[model samples]
Each structure stands twice: as structure tokens, then as C-alpha cells.
Target: MTTVYIADTGVFVRCGGPDKSKFQRLRRALQQAGVSLRIPQRVYQELGGNPAADKYPSGDIPYADGFEDGWIVVAEELDYANPLVSTVMDEVRRFIANETDRDEDIIEKADTALVGLAAQVLDTGEADHVVLLTTDKPAGRAAEALLPQHGFSDSIEFRYVSVAYLESLTADEFW
Candidate 1:
């Protein structure tokens, strides 16, 4: 089955900066696997939105290179009109809120957008399975728990993009 990798802002941030060894590691792995990561539109915005992020090396995202090289792509806008996508997004909002122990309104669209994109791809036949790479434990758990309820059992996975995870990344991981 075809699988799509959906990555979040934290994953990139965890890649560190200045040295870019982790970033290069991830890029090389994906290149060897002949696969690419699809980031939600909100994730792209989050990556570039915070000017404050520039102060830290981890925040110095070289995502422009990822985009230019075609390995990191911004996923299509969420189709809120699609019932499945909308429902999944709504559920994700609630799940994240609960997981984070915050009010539903405190949850941002970016969090839900990850799951929404996954649902959209599955509903549209864009991908048969989805692998979510993120450092946000709550959002990651939400996707892992909820997607199966929508009849995508065993088709959704959440891989916590920890420092060790990136350090050990290989093309074999994609397969």
C-alpha cells in the first residue's frame, strides 16, 4: 500500500541548526527511500511565522532548501467541506485539547491540520496509509487513536521524531 509521510513543525525544529547534520541525515534518508514529507500548510506557516525562532539554532530552519529540492512539500489546503476531513479535524481538536489538558479553543488549527490532511489524503485516495512524524506527543497520540475509529485501522502510525530517532534515521525506516 502507498504510504504518505506527514511531518509537523516540531520534527523540523528537532533537527537542530548551524551544523545541520540531523537535517542532512533526514534529507538523505528520504532521498534514498525516494519518498518525501508532506507538511500541513499551517506547519509551513509555523516554521516561518515566528521571527523569535531565529534566535535559536534549532529554529534556524533551512526549510527553503527542502522546498527547493522537492523533498519537503506543503500539503494541499484542508478541505473543510469534505465531511470526513472536517469530522476528523474536529475530533483531533478535541483530542488534542484533552491530551494537553487545555480547553478546546486553546488548540490551534495547526494541531488539527495534521490529522485533517491525513484524513483528506485517505479519503481522496491520495494515500492508502499515513505515517505522522512529530514531536508533539498529544497531536501524535490523537492521530494514532482517532484515525482507526474512522475505518483506517492499522493504516495510521505516529512516529515520535525524537533526537535519537533522527540520529538513527535510514531509508529502511521508510520501507
Candidate 2:
């Protein structure tokens, strides 16, 4: 079964700066495993869109190397026309709002795009399994909790991309 790996902005951030060894470690692991991480379009935007993000030390990501080497890709735009994609995104918004005890209006499509893309990939049979690499607790939990209910039980996994997680990463993680 093919497994699609989806990554979020935090994964790169947790890898530290452009010159950090952690960034190289992650790149090496993925390249060795022959696996590429697919980022939701929103995540791709978040990684480099904010001018302010450049002020932080961790924001100077060397992800361009991953792209140039062909191990980090920006996924296709989320297809709202796909019922499963639209439904899951809407549900994720509500799920995250409830989890944070905030009003539903406070949640945005960008916040749930990870889960939406996962749902779309799964529903369309693009992947037999989906692994989410994210530091967004709410979205990760929502994907784990909701995807199973949609008949994806055991087919979805969320790996919290912590500093330690990246520090000790190996090809085994992707396998």
C-alpha cells in the first residue's frame, strides 16, 4: 500500500535554521528513504509568506534545498469540489474550534487544510495510507479522530513533529 506523507510548516521550523544540522538530518532521512513530504498549499504559503516569520531564527528554512533535490513538494491546490475534501475541512474547522474552546468563526481554511488534503488524498484513492507530520495539535488530533470515522481507521497516523522527533529521525520513520 502506498503511504503519502503530509508535512506542515512546523516540521521545517522544528528543524531549526538553514545552517542547522537538524535540517540536514531531516533532508537526508527523507532522501534516503526515497520519500518526499507533500505540503498542503496553505502550509507552503505559511512557510514563506509571512515577512515577520523571517525575523525568527528558525524561520530561515533551507527547504529550498529539499525542493531542489526533489524531496519536499507543494501539493496541488485543495479541491473544494471534492465532497470528501469539503466535508472534512468543514468538520475540521468545527473540531478545532471546539478543541480550543473558541468560536467556530475563529477557525480558517488554512488551519484545517492539512486534514482536508489528507481526506482528499485518501478518498480519491491516491494513497492507501496517510501519515501526517505536523506540530499543530488540534489539526493532528482532528485528523486522527475524524478520518477513522470516515472508514479510514488504522489508515491514518499523526506524528507530532517535535524537536526530538527530528533529531532522532531515520529512514525507519518513513518506512
Candidate 3:
């Protein structure tokens, strides 16, 4: 079964900064495994949309290199027209809202996009499995909880990209 790695904005944001060690580590691991992390268009936008974050040290990431090196590809647009994709996104929205104890309307589309993309990948036969790499707890939890209910048990995984996780990442993780 094919396994696609879907990453979030927080994962890239975590690798940002003047020190490129963490970023370099992740790049090497992905290259060694011959795998790339696909980011949703919303995540691509979030990575470059915030002008205020440019002033911060962690904001000075060389993410463009990943794209140039072919280790970071932007995922195809989310197909809301797909019933499964739309249903999963809606479930994710409500799950995240309930998990975070906030209004469903307040949850960002980007968060739901992660799971929605995963659903799309599976429904369209793009992949049999999905590994979501994100730092957003609510989204992660929602994926871990919801995907299984949609006949995707053991087919979806949520991996929290913590600082230590990135620092010691390896090709084995991808395999």
C-alpha cells in the first residue's frame, strides 16, 4: 500500500531559524528514504503569508530549498466536491472545535485541510495510507480519532512533530 506523508505549516515553522541543523537533518532523512512531504496549499500559503513573522528568528527558514531539491511538493488542491473528502473535512472541523473547546466556526480551514487531503488521497486511490506530520494537537487528535471511523482504521496516523522528533529524525521513520 502506498503511504503519503502529509505535513502541516507548524512542521515547517518548527524547522525555521538561522540554525539549519534541524532542517538539514529532516532533509537528509527524507532524501535517504526517497520520500517527500506533501503540504496542502493552505500550508504553503501559511508558510509565506505571514509578514509579521518575518521579523522573528525562527521565521528565517530556507524552505524554498526543499521545493527546489524536490523534497517538498505542494499537494493538489482539496476536492471538496468529493463526498468523502467533504465529510471528513466537516468531521475534522467539528472534532477540532470540540477538542479545543472552541466554536466550530473558529477553527481554521488549514487544520481541516490536513484530514481532508488525507481523505481525498484515500478516496481517490492516490494512497492507501496517510501519515500526517503536524504540531497542532487538535488536528492531530481529530485525525487519529476520525479517520478510523471512515473505514480507515490503521490506515491513518498522526505524528506530532516535536523539537526532539525533528532533531533525531531518520530514514527509518519514513520506511
Best by lDDT: 1
TM-score of each: 0.90, 0.89, 0.90
Which stretches of model 3 miss by more than 4 angstroms? Answer: 17-19, 49-62
Worst 10 residues of 3 by lDDT: 49-58
Per-residue lDDT tens digits for candidate 1, residues 27-52, read 99998999999988788778873333
Q: By descending TM-score, how would the candidates be arranged?
A: 1, 3, 2
lDDT of each residue in 1-175, candidate 3, tens digit only: 7999999988877987425787888899999999999888777777763333332112434576787688887787788888888999999999888878899999999999999998888888889999999999889889889888889889889999999999999999999
Computed on alpha carbons, the lDDT of every model, listed in order, comes to 0.86, 0.83, 0.85
The whole-model C-alpha lDDT of candidate 2 against the native structure comes to: 0.83
Ranking by lDDT: 1, 3, 2
Mark the regions of model 1 whose C-alpha exceeds 4 Å error after superposition.
Answer: 49-61
